[model samples]
Target: MKYLLNSNNNILNKLKTKNTLLAFDLDGTLSPLVDDPSNAYIPDTTKCLLAKINKFKKYKVAIITGRSIASTKKILGELPLTIIGNHGLESFYAKIEEKEKWKKRCLILSSNLKDIFDQNEFFIENKKYSVSVHFIKKNRSNSTIKKLANTIKPLLVKNEAIILGKNVVNILPSNKSNKGFALKQIMKKYNLHQALFVGDDNTDESIFEIKKKDIIKIKIGMSRNSSATFYLKNQKEINSLLKLLNDVQTQGINFLCMNMD
Candidate 1:
């Protein structure tokens, strides 16, 4: 995989129009992963760059994450971008009743799972339409984690979908909603011709599944087997990527203005 900064020029050359969508995952992509999810925040520099990118009318930005919409909004504060939260189950277009139903189901599942797994061993995050089982704080051995996973696998066979991430397992509703579906919905809604997606987790695989020549899929870490077309070394490199994108957009706009003259 090529470095995103090195390939900036080539990527910019391909996406010269305003009809491009810039979508990002929240936790590991925008904000660094932390022990406590609530402590995550977008760096000031990245925030400023995103603001500049949002200023261009030709470009659209979005945040798609496993986080609930309310929590996502609270963390990011006020940003001029679309947000698809709860893994696309709690978006602007989602129905209120549908969300509530999912929430109820997740609650039931969480309660049932709590009986099998000790509450102190793992942290459970109850979102609007899903639940996240975080094991980072547990400090369990790999073999123990595997055993736990095997034990819980059978319990989630009915009406629940599971996604594995870094030290976490997300139990979402067994529905068609996901990050890829959300990306397609956003692209179709805005009539975008291309998109650039950056993420770092198993959940992000859904977005990578989209088979489109115009889409730029970037993974945050160096994973040889990742579905992403490109990979960044770590989360710190995200600032550089954002800066490059801003510079490219500025250059594109200036070039367009020069042509108009």
Candidate 2:
């Protein structure tokens, strides 16, 4: 993949005239991932850029993430965009549910699996919303997670469930509830000609690979291999890119309106 300078002003110019959408991954692309994922926020530069981008009536911006919707709205606050949460398993327009009652919509992983969370010592550190069974944990065997998966498979066989493996095992809803699916939904809903997706994690690669010929796929963080069309060093670089896009959008709008007069 090429590491393009954040100077995609030409792309923004094209987007100004056509139906376009911007989608972002929350944890690492939009904000640096901290020890606690719920603490992530839109960087100042990103917020400024998004504000500018939102000015275009035809341009739709959305934040797609693996975090729950309530978790996202808490830290992200009210941004001028839509948010696809829990890897697209849950979504909210804005203020649909009070914060306290929002946690009820998470993908209903089998209640039988609740016992697995108790049997493992590492999982004890996990809280209610976030839990991962790390197969590679030291002193623990890899088969532990597999056995757990095997046990849960029967219970979820009738429901929508899938086993996704990364740093650990995740039993997520098997519906079309992924970043890629969410992006497509946004494009169709808005009738966009093209879209841009930026992300920086294993789960994000699911969307990165699905970028159409016209869409731009950007990856953050250092990695030799990725399906991303472009690469940035980290969230700071992503912030810089957002700032540049904001400036371009401001200039593009002024240029467009001036010609209309």
Candidate 3:
């Protein structure tokens, strides 16, 4: 993948004005990656830039996250950005029937998982619309993944999906509930001409794998396996990117005075 900061010219040339969706993943993209998800919060510097970017009328700013809507809402209080939660299973516009369906599924999975895995082995997060099975000990993550994958298979519904994140396992519905599917829905809903999405893990690969030219997929941490074409080196660079984007979106992209190394 190419370094997004270095390719200022290409990045500037590709970005458009109105009907452009500027989206981000929450943890490890907008917020620092912490051992505990609850501790993850948007840095004041990054939050300010995001708030400004959201105010730009031409672009649609959104948070497409694996985070549950309720939890994300609590963290992003009064942000006023479009939020696609539970990897798209829970949203502001989702049908009531759909929400109830996932809620039921989560409860069952939570109960079933609790029977087999210990609190130390798996820190289960039942988000109503989804379930995340996390490892309590960082050193045991790789081994824990093998155990998690095997243990969850029989307990899961045929259509349910199991996705691995940064040392975490996410269980949710597979029926058009991935971030790619969510992004497509938003693209259609908003009639967006193009999009710029930034994410940091396998969970975000769904958006990166979208075979479309209009959507610019940027990975927060560079990986050769990642389908994203551009990326920031790490989460620390997120604020810089957001600041640059805010400058572009608010004042319009300037080729001459804006290129940063």
- Please estimate how well model 2 matches the true structure, expressed as its whole-model Cα lDDT: 0.61
TM-score (C-alpha) between model 1 and the true structure: 0.89
lDDT of 2 by residue, 42-111 (tens): 7665677677777777668888877666677776666757888766656542233532222331224424
lDDT at position 170, candidate 1: 78
**lDDT of candidates 1 onward, in order:** 0.79, 0.61, 0.82
What is candidate 1's lDDT per residue for 45-111, written digit by digit as tens?
7788788888877679999999988888887887868999888988876788888888788888788
Model 1: how far residue 129 lies from native, Å: 0.6
User: What is the Cα root-mean-square deviation between model 3 and the actual structure?
Assistant: 2.4
What is the TM-score of candidate 3?
0.92
Model 2 CA lDDT for position 2: 65
Tens digit of lDDT per residue, candidate 3, span 22-90?
888999898888888888788777778788877777779999999988899888878898999999988
> For candidate 2, what is the total of clashing residue pairs?
0
Question: What TM-score does candidate 2 get on C-alpha atoms?
Answer: 0.72
Q: What is the TM-score of each predicted model, taking all chains together?
A: 0.89, 0.72, 0.92
Best by TM-score: 3
